[model samples]
Target chain A: MSIGLKKARAVIRATLSKGREMGLSPLSVVVLDPGGHVVAFEREDGAAPGRFAIAHGKAFGAVMLGMPGSAQMARAEGQAYFMGAMNGLFGGQVVPVPGGVLMRDGRGRLAGAVGVTGDTSENDAEAAVAGVEAAKLVAEA
Target chain B: MSIGLKKARAVIRATLSKGREMGLSPLSVVVLDPGGHVVAFEREDGAAPGRFAIAHGKAFGAVMLGMPGSAQMARAEGQAYFMGAMNGLFGGQVVPVPGGVLMRDGRGRLAGAVGVTGDTSENDAEAAVAGVEAAKLVAEA
Candidate 1:
């Protein structure tokens, strides 16, 4: 019922492969289970050193809030202080960006999340969506 | 070459399975690539709430220092101030304990690290070593 390791790796592989095919910068992708613990992760060959942590933060944020990163951004728009406090409390694990997407199971229950980092936020989000679809799950972004 | 997501997940699964067989507490495991980036992670169903971060910190500490967590503990034995400074600088990501083990490639080159939590330090380290060996890698601890 949950997003297990096999599916998480599928999502990561799909996201990175799509990034390569689209000529985007090398990427780092992270998958997090519903409890915000890492499930699987990968950093493409040429990804920047910082991309791994960023991707993890984005995915953790999505899973922790039970929403897509884009929605978290929207919710933080007028509550900068609250968002900042939350980030501080979690040791800066929350990333308000478009790269994080919530994944749902066949029954529409929140399963986990995927986060991609390397290029623009929009591109990252696109890759995350592709990853979700590749894993045969629904992406809520 | 690098510790890919597949190998990382393999290590985690091996470790958790062993833990269950040994009747240890539910565990959280983490694998990190040479660059100190997460490769894969898992938290067992009944693992304590704080185990995820502790597992990650232990693995990250091993990779960042290029040594086993026990070695880091030894080095920090008489350098409390220095270790404290390092922890402060890295936002407390370093965990000096026996649960972290450095991984080596076939050629004995440093590859990454595996860390396990939710049991006694010795038991955690034992699990990590078993995990690394299960993945057909070397555990230098």
Candidate 2:
């Protein structure tokens, strides 16, 4: 199932809320559809610069590879050259790191991916997961 | 969060002051809005050739990507091809290196960015920071 704009906005809000709750740094979050296009994004006040692109890179990489960001990170470790090539092919939009999480519907259909930045990678992942779960979707990170 | 012309000029003046105080080489400084459009700039006497373009690229990359130039440089190391493609996409304006700093207002909203050149990258960054501070803005280098 494709992600709608409403859901995308909800994901962003939830992600930001999670970051606030966790006391993480000001965050940037992006929600991308299965096609790797940005559905919605938000860069919080005081967040680091380039966060939107960074967040997009994480989610785009996850969606493009059809894997969770954690898995992508693992693959990047094992296939550094391939990942590098893919990153080039994708115009440097693929960030093989944590904080990119794939979303699935109750019936296990791919919806989209959520990417979070402006904090530690691990913390970003946590925020993404919370956001997806808050929207009643399963997060695969 | 945009910087006015007056503040932009102040940033330029302060940057030059820092350079003069430190006795660095002649310097060029470019201030760009969040959209990567040049707001104000100056080239000190005896500044190296093409310094304006160099400074512009630095500031443009930071403002366009919404990240400090130093962070861009770090990302460029592992994603060489990706960075190359990005550079080409932006008309070779993306300089993935230090000497570019993001400006933030009191509310932490991004105001603009400053790019300094004609000296060591580190020194250029310091001057940019000082310039932003002189304008009463926060610097993220």
RMSD for all candidates, in order, please: 3.9, 3.8
Query: By DockQ thresholds, what CAPRI class is model 1?
Result: acceptable
* Candidate 1 lDDT by residue in tens digits, A1-141: 568767887898899888878889978888888887676667765566687689988988888777788988887897888878878988899998899999998899988888899999999999999999999999997
Q: Report the C-alpha lDDT of model 2 over B1-141, residue by residue, as the tens digit.
A: 788899999999999999999999999999998877889999999987799999999998888677788888887787554455346445578888889999999988889999999889999999999999999999999
Candidate 2, residue B127: lDDT: 92
> How well does candidate 1 match the true structure in TM-score terms?
0.75
Minimum summed lDDT over a 10-residue window in model 1 chain A is located at: A40-49
Clashing pairs in 2: A49-B66, A49-B67, A50-B66, A50-B67
Model 1 chain B is weakest, by summed lDDT over 10 consecutive residues, at B40-49
Question: Which residue runs of candidate 1 sit more than 4 Å off their true CA positions?
Answer: A1-10, A13-25, A63-67, A72-91, A106-108, A134-136, B1-10, B13-25, B72-86, B106-108
Off by over 4 Å in 2: A77-80, B17-23, B44-50, B61-97, B104-110, B133-141
Here the TM-score of candidate 2's chain B is: 0.97
**How closely does chain A match the true chain A in each prediction, as TM-score?**
0.94, 0.96
User: For candidate 2, lDDT tens digit of each residue in A1-141?
Assistant: 989999888888999999999999999999988888888999998664566777888898899889877887777778767777777677777777789899999999999999998887899999999999989889999
